[model samples]
Target: MTNDFSPLSQWQLDRARRTVHRGGVIAYPTEGVWGLGCDPWNPDAVEEILELKQRPAHKGLILVAASTDQIEFLLAPLDPEMRERATRHWPGPVTCLLPDPEDRVPFLVKGDHSAIAVRVSDHPVVKALCEAAGQPLVSTSCNPAGRPPARHGWQVRRYFGQGQVHIVPGALGGNRKPSRILDIVTGQWLR
Candidate 1:
């Protein structure tokens, strides 16, 4: 399948933001592959992503933000050392599991976990989308459970079908692997 959603333009970004604001899901380029995203605060939107990917709710989802400020609530509780360790790899392909005090993240996004997985994206499209959305977004690989993540827009459409998700056209970053997951408290690599 061929994709019309390439070389992301400002108009496409606006459309994607509108779709997200209306509680719709979208597919956009990430550091390594296409990712499905939605407003993290919207349960319906999050559920749509899970349904489209056939992902179990217990697995949770990763949240991507444009800047650390967008997720300060989740990061504020960490001590200085843990906070530094958690944020040392920001704006890159690294996801950190941090303690969620006050539980600002919804249970669906956090799943059954006490910590939330988050990343401050360095990819321009992802950063712009999060900035346009004005908050963190729920991000998961753009494919069903057990399937390889979509590497291109057409693959995203083939997996979820056109019109099911707003396709935000862009190129993946240079990373060849998904973001490495690290637990801030244990200094362990979860991925």
Candidate 2:
């Protein structure tokens, strides 16, 4: 999908990319709401997000990427049909749980599960941020477990305060709800 939306300044994108590379957490707009993202391979960064949201480690987190190629290492093992099933709903508000047989993903990112949740986002800001970081990022709702996900920049600020997370400037995508999550391996709708 084409991403003509460019709501963020180059400086903002660069700062976010730097923060991710430095193992800091950042809040950026996503398909339905603001999202907290960090380098998925950085365990400390992932822990910071979990702590900020008061989320349990076992729940795992989703990885968002600019394109399927960014996550090709994980998807390459799946059969052609299973891979197609997951890719068909991507570049949009859909997350698919795919088996991580080779354990390419970190334990913190996958939690206790054998499968990891991932999405290829069409949101320009998300795509840009992922591209800037040159890897998939750990994505979770900006709010704490019980709080509503942040839909506005101010909401993100209110939830985590200014210095807690580096806020990447942008507006949420048109989706009114969070991404639909599906377990492609089991053919189950998880959300």
Candidate 3:
């Protein structure tokens, strides 16, 4: 699907990218709401996300990529049919739980599970951020646990406050609900 969502200026995107690379968190627009993102490979950054959201480490997190190639490591272990089924929903709001072989994903991001939740976003700003960061980002709704996700830049600031999260100004991509999560192995709908 074409991303008709509002765009962020080059400087804003650059700063957000830098923040992620430096192990800092960023708040950016997603398909349904604002999301907090950090480098998935950076354990410190993931810890910050967990602390900010008041979320437990065992709950796991979602990773958002700009393209399927960014998550090839996680997809390499799936069978052909299962891989095809999962990749077909890419560049959209569908989050698929796929097998994580070799434990490539960090324990904090995968939690206690052998599967990791992932999505290739169609949101323009998110795609840009991921491209700039050169990998998929650890993404979670931009709010404390049990609270509503932020839908606007102002709300992100309100929730995280200044200096807490670098807000990447943009608009949501018109998805009314959070992405539908499915387990590729069992064909189960998780959300």
Best prediction by lDDT: 2
Q: Give stretches of model 3 more than 4 Å off.
A: 1-4
Worst 10 residues of 2 by lDDT: 1-10
lDDT of 1 by residue, 39-113 (tens): 989999999999999988888999999999999998878899999997889978899998887888999899999
Q: Of models 1 and 2, which has the larger TM-score?
A: 2
lDDT of 3 by residue, 98-144 (tens): 89879999999999898999999888888899999999998999999
lDDT of each: 0.89, 0.92, 0.89
| lDDT, residue 139, candidate 1 | 94
User: Can you tell me which runs of candidate 2 are displaced by over 4 Å?
Assistant: 1-6
Of the candidates numbered 1 and 3, which has the greater TM-score value? 3
How many times do residue backbones clash in model 1? 0
- The TM-score of predicted model 3 comes to 0.95
Q: Residue by residue across 1-191, what tens digits does model 2's lDDT show?
A: 23445677788888999999999999998888899999999999999999999999988999999999999998999999899999999888899999999999998889999999999998999999999999999999999989999989999888998799998887777888778999998788989
Compute the lDDT for candidate 2: 0.92
TM-score of predicted structure 1: 0.94
> Estimated TM-score per prediction?
0.94, 0.95, 0.95
